[model samples]
Target: MDRGERFDRLRLARTERVGPVAFDQLVKRFGSAGAALEALPHLARRGGADGFSIPPEHTINAELEAGEALGARLLVLGDDGFPPQLAALDPPPPVLWTLGDPGLLSKNACAVVGARIASSAGLRFARGLAAELGQAGLTVTSGMARGIDGAAHEGALPTGTVAVLAGGIDDVYPPEHDNLWGRIREGGCIVSEQAPGVRAKAHDFPRRNRIISGLSRAVVVVEAELRSGSLITARLAAEQGREVLAVPGSPLEPRAKGTNDLIRQGAALCEGAEDVLRALAAPRTLREPDGRWDGAVPDDEVDAVRDRVLALLSPTAIPRDELARGVGAPAAVVFAALVELALAGEAELLPGGMVCRS
Candidate 1:
């Protein structure tokens, strides 16, 4: 992409309601970010948005400058050196703000995650497992939280590690890990999908977990309660077709309940780094890039399709294929309409290819 196109893509991403899915759809449909920007208002209006507003150019420019001032760089999707594993995620982050050595992202990686209030044995096991994985030439990845996450990064720091943050690349959470954050920048990497200086919210953690699991070849859960965020990461890993491995713990311990449940659900039982290495030996295929269409539907036909698709959608989530059938339109057309609805804030695409009214 040219410089102008790059700026346009960033501008489009920063626009209100333009998330990863909408960004991808706009780029594919309009063939360039500049063209997409030109068409956004019309599209949004057609999809029932009252008035569409494009983010001012100065806002985007200021964000870029802020990231640069922090000694961090932005990695837009499709840019050279962007991690292919992360790119394989459905609705992959449209952009990433990264600090330290971004080169660590391409290394063989495994995620070690567990409870924030981890047990002594869990912390020791996580540290040892991370050290072994790093010694075997794999970069360890994790959220820079307390307990198991901290131990895992500490152990793997000598080799390499990547911390996928829930907030901005520069916003340190928990306050106490400031030193560890600095150390990570010195020898490893810190990455975030949010714009620089944005503080994390409650919802950002689950979103961050997906990126952690998406970046790694496998995710290991050391100790977790049944409803902990560690389980969320393990579940995302499985959904992404990455290996999910959990250390079996005693059934009596609450912290072990999640890992034990994972093992019972057929996630690989991980006693040590060796178990993870063995699981990694199996061949796996990364998700392919989304297909694009060069043909364009006439404006009237697109309007009709949108109306039909909208009529079929309800507050309850429905399968995308079923909605397409109900609308009597091609799957791609229905998908494009759904993307418009999403961009207009009228619909939401849930996990498992389901959609519902927003």
Candidate 2:
């Protein structure tokens, strides 16, 4: 892509309501980001939006400048250094701000995640497992949180690790990990989907977790409570068809409950790094990429389909296939219409192929 086209893609991605899926649809439907930007207002209007505006060029420029100032660079999708594993995700981040060595993304990786207030034994196990995995030639990846995450990174730092941050690449959360964050920049990598300077929010953790799982060949749950974010990452790893490994913790420990439950449900039982390595050796089926639209729907036909799809939507999200059946439209056509609705802020595309009116 040329410089101008790259700028357009960045602008489209940062535009309100234009998420990863919407960005993909716009580019595929219009043949280029430049063309997509030109058609965005019309598409939004056709989907019942009162107004639509692309982000100003200066805003994108400022973001780029900030990343540069922080020693980070933007890795737009399709760029030379973008990780292929992450690209294989159903809807990967359109752009990622990256710091430190970009080359680490090419290596085989595993995620080690667990409770922030972990027991001493859990921390020791995580650290040893991480070091063992690192020595076994796998890059350890984790969110830069306290307890288990910190221990894992410290163990793997002598080799390599990747820290997927929930906040901006330059912003440090939890306040006390400043030294670890700096060491990660020197030894491994720091990455985020959000623009520089943005603070971490409560909702960003799940999104961050998906990227963590997406970038790895497998995810290991050291210790987690039922409601913990570590479980969320494990679930995402399963959804992404990556291997899920859980440490067998004591039944009396609260943090072990989630891992035990996962093992009971057939997640691979992890005793040490050897378990993870053995699981990685097993061949697993990978999900094929979703088929793309050929942009065959005529403008008038799209309008009709949009209306029909809208009629089936409510505050309650329904499966995309169910909406397609209700509207008597082809699934691809319904998806295209929903993309337009999503970009217009008239609908939401949830996880698991679900959709609902916004």
Candidate 3:
């Protein structure tokens, strides 16, 4: 893509109601970043708006400057060396702001995530597993939060690691990890989907967790509560057809329940790094088509479908299947509409296609 085209694509990405799915559909349908950029406002307006607003060119330029100031460049999803696993997600991040050695992402990766207030044992286990996994030539990936995530990065630092953050690459969420962030930028890498200057928010964490799992071959959940963010990453990994590994914890510990339940559901019980590597080495093909349409809904139909979907959804969580059935729309249309709603900040897409008004 040329410079103007690249900027146009970035503009599209930063536009209101334009997300990965819509972006991909636009690109695939239009056949170039240039075309997609030209088509974005038209699509948005067709979906029912007199006008559409994108991030100002000055803002995007400022973000680029900030990334450059930090010695980080923006890595678009389809760029050479972008993690294939991450790129394969239905709605992969459009661009990543990365610091340190981008080549670290080329190495095989295993994500290690858990509670921020993980148990001492869980921390130790994560550290040891990361150390061994690094020794085995695997790159560790995690959200660089406290406890398990911090330990995992520290353990893997000698070899390399990837820290996917909830904020900009230059913005460290947990203030305590400022020094740790510097270390990773020097010895490993830090990346983010949000633009520079974006502060970490609660909603950004799960989006960040998706990248943590999406970039890896497997996700290891060490100690996570039933509702922990780490378990969210584990679920995303499973849905992505990546191996799900759970390190057993004491049943009495509330944090362990998520992992234990995952094990009961057939996630591999991880005893050690060897178990993780073995699972990664196992022969498997998760690239099957699964019969899902890889196309986007026509622009003219986008808003009508979105409104129908909105009518069927409620504050109470409802299964997406039932919502689609109630709306009498194809599942793919519902999925695309949900993606649009999510981008527009009108709805939230939960795991398993469930959505609720934001």
Can you give the TM-score per candidate against the true fold?
0.95, 0.96, 0.87
Q: In each prediction, how many residue pairs overlap at the backbone (N, C-alpha, C within less than 3 A)?
A: 0, 0, 0
Model 2 residue 121 CA deviation (Å) reads 0.8
The residue-by-residue lDDT of candidate 1 on 1-358, one tens digit each, is: 6778888988998888787767776787888889999999988888888898998999999999999999997888888888988877776777888999999987889999999999999999999999999999999999999999999999999999999999999989879999999999999999998889999999889889988999999999999999999999998898888999999999899999999999999999999989999999999886654453223456776677897787778899998878877988876777778877877898887644578988
Candidate 2's displacement at residue 321, Å, is 2.4
The digit string of per-residue lDDT tens for model 3 on 75-131 reads 776678677777777667778888999888777899998989988899999999999
**Between the candidate structures 2 and 3, which one is better when assessed by TM-score?**
2
Q: What C-alpha lDDT values do all the predictions have?
A: 0.88, 0.88, 0.80
> At residue 294, what lDDT does model 2 achieve?
33
Please, what are the lDDT tens digits per residue for candidate 2 over residues 1-358?
A: 7898888888988998888877777787788888988988888888778998888999999999999999997888878889988888777778899999988887899999999999999999999999999999999999999999999999999999999999999888778999999999999999999999999999889989989998999999999999899999998899889999999888988999999999998899999999999999999875655674335467777777888788789999887778888988776678878887987788997654678899
Please list the residue runs of candidate 1 whose C-alpha ends up more than 4 Å from where it truly belongs after superposition.
289-296
Judged by TM-score, which candidate is best?
2
- The superposed Cα distance between candidate 2 and the true structure at residue 68, in angstroms, equals 0.8
In candidate 3, position 210 carries an lDDT of: 83
- Could you tell me the TM-score of candidate 2? 0.96
**Which ranges of candidate 2 are over 4 A from the true structure?**
292-296
Question: What lDDT does candidate 1 reach at residue 206?
Answer: 87
Q: What is the C-alpha RMSD of each candidate to the true structure, in Å?
A: 1.7, 1.4, 3.0
